[model samples]
Target: MLSIMFYIAITAEAMTAALAAGRRNMDWFGVCLIACVTALGGGTTRDMFLAHYPLYWVANPYVLLLVCGAALLTVAIARLVDRLRWPFLLLDALGLVVFTIVGCNIGMEAGVHPIIVIVAGMVTGIVGGILRDVLCNDIPLVFQGELYATVSIVTGVVYYLGLLAGLPADIVVLIALAVGFPLRVAALVFKWEMPRFVFDREMRK
Candidate 1:
């Protein structure tokens, strides 16, 4: 439910990014296709592995329409897009946060252990971007040592902990988002990154 909307939002962001990069034209079909695949790819992977049956959009066609309509709406905003990069990032973060929460939920429902729930949440967050980058032929932002996937993993940990504390589902998701999204934005703003390997010496030396 909410997870699908998260995908729609992510799809919208990535579709517009693709359009801006000229990888995809701002046509109806292109918009819809990119939106659906970009948004749903990660969650779909998780669901298939967990055997969630019939998949999400197949179980509810409205979600498909939601993604399509979102892409169409994004076209109108194209004029002001140059002024909206932060908005795009914010939307992308929200979508990631939402999907992370949903993935955590699925993990619990599937009877996964706590550590595995964290893994599931991070996978749900990252794999979509991986698919999006691969399809768009862009360098994956996730692997740039940036704080992207790290934030997702942190949020997933929070979700599992909150779940163990017997928090309400809505509260658990909200906590995860509240913690996760801003950290992601801050990481982007400050260019926060994890240290890369130096091989203990310069390779060129």
Candidate 2:
């Protein structure tokens, strides 16, 4: 079940990223590149940090084809996708939580400390979006005072504790999704944002 959601989340991330590439007027190849980066960059980073050999996409090369295929399909149906903005936003939120859970699982498997596990989850959840925004020449959304990374952290904590409590793994996944997904949706719906520290003064020459 987790693997299935992972694939769906990857496809959704690629499609949304392809739309972002289109907004920047990137060519087809550029679109596919952005899609691949956005869909897989986070997991790649996590694996590298953990020194986990045979990165996920490298082990399953078909996933690259999956990302690129979804991207090109989005290109063909860009207008339809644009019209379904809310659905895509929900999918993106889902991707964040699912990716975080998967990363946390990997960290646990690597015998890392608990703190590192949560951080691993966070890196997986937000780094891909950060990379996408950077490539699109925008400030990364995770650094934009949104509730993004916080949601990932909260989800990871819940998932890890649930597992530590000896809950069934499947139930833990569902519980994490339940907690994280609605928190993100509420953040979006309510326009919730972290307070900013503004420093607008210019130094005298």
Candidate 3:
């Protein structure tokens, strides 16, 4: 079940990246590259931070192939996808939830502290989108006061607490996803945001 979720998450992420690439008028190679980065960047970063050997995509090359195929499909259906903006947002939200759960589990398996585990989840959930936005030359949504990163962190914390409460793994995963997906979608619909930092010019001096 977790493996299925992981595959869905990466495919959704790849599609999102491919759409962004198309928006930027990138070629097929560029689209595929961005898609892979968006799908795997977070996991790679999390693995590096944990000093885990053999990054996931490297260990399972099939994951890369999966992402590439998703990207290609996105390019082929780019117009249809563009017309279905809500579907993209929904898929992205789902991916965020899945990645958070996966990251949290990985951290726990690594025997990290609970707080660090939560942080690991947040990193894994958001870093891929961050890299995608950077490559696409847009301000990353997380930094723009969107609820994106907040949802990631909160989902991680919820999952962590669920484990501490001795919940079944599947139940914990479902609970985390249930909490995150609505929160993210509501935030998008309501334009919910954290207050942006504002530094006065004189403060800089």
Provide the TM-score for each candidate, comma-separated. Answer: 0.84, 0.97, 0.94
C-alpha-based local distance difference test score of model 1:
0.74
What TM-score does structure 3 among the candidates reach? 0.94
- Tens digits of per-residue lDDT, candidate 1, 1-205, equal 5655665566656545445434444466655666677767777888888887778778887777766666676676666664677777788887777778778878888897887777777777778777766666677888778788889899998888987899987787778878998999999899999877666556668
| lDDT on C-alpha atoms for all candidate structures | 0.74, 0.95, 0.91
* Model 3 error, position 160 (Å): 0.6
Quote the positional error of residue 50 for candidate 2 in Å.
0.7
- Writing each residue's lDDT as its tens digit, candidate 3 over 78-145 gives 88877888877888898888898889988998999999899889889999999999999999989989
Indicate the residue-level lDDT of 3 in model 3.
78
Separately for all candidates shown, the number of backbone clashes (residues 3 or more apart, or on different chains) is 0, 0, 0
**What lDDT score goes with residue 4 in model 1?**
58
- Report the C-alpha lDDT of model 2 over 1-205, residue by residue, as the tens digit: 9888889999999999999999999999999999999999999999999998799999999999999999999999999999999999999999999999999999999999999999999989999999999999999988888999999999999999999999999999999999999999999999898888777557433
Off by over 4 Å in 2: 203-205
Instruction: Report the candidate with higher lDDT, 1 versus 2.
Output: 2
The superposed Cα distance between candidate 3 and the true structure at residue 37, in angstroms, equals 0.7
> Which has the better TM-score: candidate 2, or candidate 3?
2
Say what the RMSD of model 2 is: 1.5
